[model samples]
Target: MHDQNFTSLPDLHGVPVFYPHGTQLIWISSNGEITRPSRETLAAEFALGVVLLCHRRWSAARAAIDIDHYLDVMELFAFVRPARFVLPTPSGLAQQLGLARPQQGEDMAALLPQIAFILLDELASTPDPARTEAGRIATMMTAGGWKWGPYILAHLGLPQPLAGPPDSRYAAIWDRLADYTDYTPQAEPGTQPILPDAARQRLAEMLGENAELRLPQADYAAAVAASFDRPDAGPNPAMVLAEAGTGTGKTLGYLAPATLWAEKNGETVWISTYTRTLQHQIANELTRLYPEAEAHESKVVIRKGRENYLCLLNLEEALAQMPGRPRQAAALGLMVRWAGATRDGDLTGASFPAWLMDLFGRSQTNGPCRPARRMYSCSLPAL
Candidate 1:
């Protein structure tokens, strides 16, 4: 039955049959005849077509077929309930893969089959064979002996299932933050101070050879460097407030001396910004000093209010109510995928797509569920 290379789609269509208890499988013929086939028959016919399509499209490095026009053939095959978890919708899958949204007036539903197959490919191709969400689902499918499982296992070679819940280093990070202690002031070590000229020179070096030196920016840098000379016995701390218009290099000006002071004194420096956008800009600027992603992550931290991040407990609670709430569930499932992939877990500023946030609405992203909270906060070692 699977031997025929399907150049064009047959009349067969599979539609998800959702019940109060769970989802069921039903087939629709081209003549508009609706029928419920036995599991064995479903496997031999409908399931075989879906598998063949998957093989025909994704078996190689790239798909041989467009698979866009065959959404109806792959529709019923997309719905899978493995033990407890509900897979995200195709739109959520697209978001997780960092794919761009469909254009205005385009039908996103038409691309579901393609999105679903891409997601399956990702699940089957996870590196190092870890106990990821992919592995967990694969294990569940193998254990349950789902009709379509073998085709996926044989063609894509799903990662071997490891025992226990999926590994969540992301969740563990937030848990460790619960024991966060108050910052204790430390004595600044006596080191040769960096004067204004030296600070200006450092700024120039950071800006690179092509950068034009601005007189005002250099003056600002020198003033900031001079502030580091405050005596330990001073009753009040030295503060400098310089008013400058946009594009005057205020960020690099201040950062030049601040970084020098911190490096010389072996101290932590905190640079506060009024907006998240500026915070991200400052973080990007820090990259010139620390080019490597891992190095940058180690040296710079972006701090924000607790409400700005995703709470793991809240996500768990949301996932539990996925039975009827398909939209929210899809968003939550995408968040679950994102949780594993995000670097800092900043829901607003991190890699999580802004459009995906609009999917489930703001409630889920607002860091609700106050009872037991664990939030992803960005942090760096030195500054």
Candidate 2:
């Protein structure tokens, strides 16, 4: 209904308009519950026209257009619409055909002429009333899929110029829209030891092993005994920055205290290291001794920032819009694949390089230092 009679009508957002042969007036209505004729909707309707033409293998079409063309044709409708168009072929089909080569300078503008010609050819070839209507309907779907242009046209009240070759100014507009391709058929805070007894014990051992410390048998016994006697035998928020001087059983000293405190205080005991070597040393030591703690340690995640959490929402949006580096794109893709099942935001499938390690910290919560850290009484005893 729209393609044949409404092609030349102005975009009035989503409103609809009708013209009668030799008639002085056209009927117009806003697209609400009633759905009036507008350029916004018409643009979408036209996009569907592109898709239909593309589908039927009609890749060339032409409509007589002039400076007045923009104003006059849309006058038939109720609103102005986006003047945007793609040239070589519709993005939907181009991707489908697997001929979606990277776009270049003139690709977008060049495709518009081809699409215009294609539409003209399709209209010329169609004979059946139902088939012709069906073709038009399909075009609507394809065009509607592209919501950006219609939105800009409707909201911004921009005129779709119908004059000669689009100027450099308009080329910038096209360039901005170079990659609106629809692709792929795919889908906070708080500390405290919430882990179960078994999980807690596992966590304790994991931390102990991570520090790779072996306090003297006497020290380990004393720390564990001290933890057992404390009002609560779990970790407290204590800052422990251990520097090994010569042969200080640094591993033993760190492990005994971390394990005992975490187990006793019932809180996560964060161990920040200045070097990757230290981080690994603690991890290896802890794992070697308390293998059972490995799983819990894995759960003891190193959260960085909100951006690291796979941000499935932002990822899909970015992909659709086309932004960021190739690495970013790849990271988002990996995130899309793994994020659904990951609660802690840890991606065990791939190793995050040291350079990328800092990216995870982007998600860290900002605030005054933790209260536990500020108060000595609350700080877990390091002895």
Candidate 3:
């Protein structure tokens, strides 16, 4: 139904999102009333949910959008499903895709198929719903997946762009984020590396002076490799420090050696960075070089200051945790969306605004469910 008629996001933020449970479009309220939302509300929410799941797939498909075409197609991304809800494909992927500039022929009507297709697979997997108001909608697209443009044209007349509810909190957190949570299929973890020398040599070879463009900087890399290969020593592992100007391959120099050592030792390598962007940068590099290890978020993982990752457990309790607090309802709604949609759970998942961050801190009534540092081990911890 949405692909048929709605052009913009349904006007449904804070209207209460719901899912198809068996047949009925029922919402269990705070008082436990089984209620049904209005037609517009249900349509908007189902649309939002579908997009939330498709964010990463959608981003991967269009990651490298050319800047010239960015504005022309900007409206397509605004407050819609998925893109607005989830973190985007990282900048590295986007730039690599080399998104093409919008050609002179492109327009909204021309882009409908692209927009609707984002939710195609998601809708197909959606549980069956009774042919109630929402169910009738399922009838059309469910029969055939990804008919967004035709469905919208035949059913929905025009999609009008919508703004999220007036509540500043939803916009504060969700607005800055783009959906990119899709694309990780659970892959087998690689075998623990048995060859320390092999790992180091591999790193050196990749970045060695003989390599293309002369990467590896043999001098810096040799020093890093030596520490890991140190013979039989004390409990305190050797640490070596070396510095060089830009273009010196410092990041890779350490990464190649560290990766190999960590794999061989079955130890966790902590790569600390001040910025989330750099954190993601290192993670991306690891993914490229050691995809299997990075996939498991083991062999290599990202550890930050902890406050940055959204706490799924604490976020769910925002309302019950502090009833009657100003903006509690809106904050809860926003947090719920972020919690469900985010993959990495980082505060930057949505470029989280400071004001929204305050809502997650020690509220007057409730404290954090657990220490933030323990978040990675158990994000959904009990209070």
How much lDDT does each candidate structure score? 0.50, 0.32, 0.39
In candidate 3, what are the lDDT values of residues 227-345, reduced to their tens digit? 66444455675666778778877777677777776656655566667786876777676664655754545445555544555543455345344333433442343344334344555
TM accuracy, model 2: 0.29
Global lDDT for candidate 2? 0.32
lDDT of 2 by residue, 1-383 (tens): 11223355434333332221121212233342222234444354434322112211111112111111111121111011111112323353234234454263234223322333333343345466423332322232223232122222222233333222212121111121122222223222222322223333433454454554434432433333332233344467322233555565456445555555555555455666676556556666665445776564553434332333333333334444322222233223222222322333332212322223222332221122222212111222211
The number of the candidate with the highest TM-score is 1
The model with the greatest lDDT is 1
TM-score of each: 0.58, 0.29, 0.46
In the order shown, the candidates' Cα RMSDs to the true structure are 11.8, 21.4, 16.0
Error of 3 at 199 (Å): 6.1
- Per-residue lDDT of candidate 1, residues 176-224 (tens digit): 2443223445785655467888899879877989988798888888888
Worst 10 residues of 2 by lDDT: 74-83
**CA shift at 204, candidate 2, in angstroms?**
15
